[model samples]
Target: MGEDRREDMLDALHRLAEELGETPTTTEMNDRGEYWASQYQNEFGGWNEALREAGFEPNQVWKVPTDDLLNEIRQLARELNQTPTKEQMDDRGEYYGRSYLKRFGSWNEAVRQAGLEPNQRISQSAFREPPDACRLCGDAPDAGLDFHHWRYGENKAGCYLCRTCHDDVHAGGMRPDNDPGWLMGAVENLIRCHAKYSEETSVPAITSRYNIPSEGLVASAMSNVEM
Candidate 1:
């Protein structure tokens, strides 16, 4: 009975894949996989093993559409209102990143290879000149200057934050410490402080909103915040 159900699901998925004119997105596959797994629990043992036998990998295959097949599918998807799944986007991003690495050597190299503009260099002479007050704390003799990411690269065009606010945000907002209530409080405080004290009039209020940080410097920076 379970085997029969599994076969039915596989057939359905195959049909959907055919209809899409491409490999199903990870989400699509996983949804189907889960349904099949539940329906065929006794025969397949579990979703993971069943999927593995069915030529599905939780990671690699799910990460992106199947290579050239993906590009074709993407073209088709674009014509319709349908958007690619998050996993599909991530997979494609990884693919692009890998391609960038191959053309260059690292992420920085990839950025440079793509002819993206480099970050502006701050001179040592500039560091010696101190601002009147802490950008975040509103205190004088600001202990250090740090860079903060305002909008993560994944979600928006990136921006910077000053050291005090940066540290406060990290210590208060990231995972473990990543409780929404706490982050909201912290971000609100940071924003209020920035609004009241920071010399930069253009600084936007820090709202305690939640978002997943990307997997590099942004992640590290947020992680380093001592909660």
Candidate 2:
């Protein structure tokens, strides 16, 4: 039954991608698909992986510069008017908390590096506390709650969540590598830059700038500009 369901899902995903003429967003999948997007996320590691299985282009987050990430952290700290807390980051940060930890050893270390006091420290018990209330869904003490990793792997951050929300979070997966919004923004900027550059110059100039010999390669690059 699991194998059959997987096949059905792949077929449905390809059909949707074909209908849309581009990869279907998870929101579109949930709204228009026969299967819930969560199911695909559960079966596959992420929605992008599902799209790959369906022979569609995966929604890959492009490579981001480390300086850009650090700058973003500093900007967030400035906007908050205080050192940003891990929980607050869960709400507002552009990048995952683990990215900071991986870059700076710990959240406090990251904050200190950003020239902010680590006064608003994150505690493990905030993840363990009460063991009754769900942080993600705000369930009452009577409702069951579980500890969930906001980021995976060793020494990662976590939070409390109701059972349903916990399952959803796991099934929904995470972009551990890059921020989805930031990646999309980067893609848009690249497209805009490419379009403007092409509009301002001749194709021969573009080919010369990139040192390409064949017009065929230039055509290929133009065709894949959206990607």
lDDT of 1 by residue, 47-102 (tens): 45555555656354433333443353344235432332222322543243333223
- Evaluated against the true structure, the overall lDDT of model 2 is 0.56
Clashing pairs in 2: none
Q: Candidate 2 residues 1-227, lDDT tens each?
A: 48888999999986665433346788878977788899899999888888888776675532345565566667877887655665555468766564565556666566667766453333443343333234333354455566654335676555555676555543423333455443223223323344543453345544433223344545554555563
The TM-scores of all predictions, comma-separated, are 0.25, 0.29
Q: Which residue runs does candidate 1 get wrong by more than 4 Å? A: 12-36, 57-227
Enumerate residue pairs that collide in model 1.
Answer: none
Runs of candidate 2 with Cα error greater than 4 angstroms are 1-63, 120-227
Clashes of each: 0, 0
RMSD (Å) per prediction: 16.6, 25.5
lDDT of 1: 0.40
